[model samples]
Target: MDHNIILFRLYIIIALCFLIPLSLLVSIQLYSLFKSYALTYFLLNFFLNNNKVNCNNKDYDTLFILLLKQQRFFLCISSVEYLLSLRYSELDPLYMLLAYCYQNHNFCYVAEYYYLKALSCSPNNEIILSKLTQVSSKLSKHPKLYTNDGLIL
Candidate 1:
């Protein structure tokens, strides 16, 4: 009886040693997931509410910075698309923002299109010109002007 009791106690201790760390890891994971979801919810609500009114550059900048910090490029793209649908007069920045999101996703063609739109709106914007150049280079392809014999047309 004494030996059985000791063995039971040892088993209990071993089980607790494993269980405790497992529970702690699970709790930490859950907490982080909850925190991320809560932040995403809050930011989405903030963005939707702000869109109801006429937002200035500062507001969009804040939202853009937050979304970028969170690495929520799709959300940024969608939000910018929604704003673009509203036909805001100062569209250069919106176009630039959309181009940036597309660029991050490696959609160089779409990024180039938006960058061109932005450049058309603000012809003197060096930043837009630079971004357009970068995307253009990425999308560029060498022409096949020479024949199989290396003869020029």
Candidate 2:
């Protein structure tokens, strides 16, 4: 009976050794996911609020960097679009962000359009010019590859 109790205790210790690390890993993942979701929600609310004029470019830049780091291109595009709908319509950076998001999604034509818009906003911007040239060449190389909606066929 004493031997059986010792074996049971050993088994419990082994189980805990495995379970503790597993539980820690799972909790870490859950916490990371929760943080990501909370940040996304906050960003959505920040962009959607009507009183955006009170916010500055630094705040937008920080949010843009965060969205990019998270690889949330759709949210980045939507947020830039909302900003453009406001007084930032002529902002070259907003156009550039939109172009980049579309390019990442393989919408080369739409990307080219926004790149051109960005270039129009800042005619001397070498980066926008280079991106436009690249997208233009891509479109030329595969003229029939994308449908009217700019999705690859």
Candidate 3:
């Protein structure tokens, strides 16, 4: 009985050690999602929810990056815009985000532009080059939103 109790206690300790961090991370992710969505709500309501916890640029950026990595382009847009407005005085766009958004929106040529711009920042990146090639190929193969006297062609 004593040996069983000792083993049970050890198992509980190990499980709690793992679960505590996992739960904390999950809660933080949930809060980040809620806070980001709150920005789209009424201004007063946004402020009310925002006042509960002040997240800095890094926190917002991390969440934004996570959303982008998840291929949640539309969701990340608000986060990117918020991060840009907060950190940059002139509000410079994140080229990667712009490329992802445009590509998702079916603006292949425009996405190619931003992807090229992003490639300039990371010249040797295979991912950026691959995305650029993909978008460029798409641009050449399909009718764009504007071409040939404002007609899709």
Highest-TM-score candidate: 2
Candidate 1 weakest lDDT stretch, 10 residues: 136-145
lDDT of candidate 2 over 11-95, digit per residue (tens): 9999999999999999999998788778777866866776555677777887888788789998788888777777773589999
What clash count goes with each model?
Answer: 0, 0, 0
Prediction 2 global C-alpha lDDT: 0.82
**Alpha carbon lDDT of residue 72, candidate 2?**
90
Cα lDDT listed for each candidate: 0.83, 0.82, 0.66
Q: What does each candidate score in C-alpha RMSD?
A: 7.2, 7.6, 10.8
lDDT of 1 by residue, 70-99 (tens): 798988889888888877778999999999
Native-to-model Cα distance after best TM-score fit, residue 105 in candidate 2, in Å: 1.5
TM-score of predicted structure 1: 0.62
Model 3, 59: alpha-carbon shift in Å?
A: 2.6
Model 1 residue 94 distance off true place after TM-score fit, in angstroms: 0.7
- State TM-scores per candidate: 0.62, 0.69, 0.43
Evaluation by TM-score, superior candidate among 1 and 2: 2
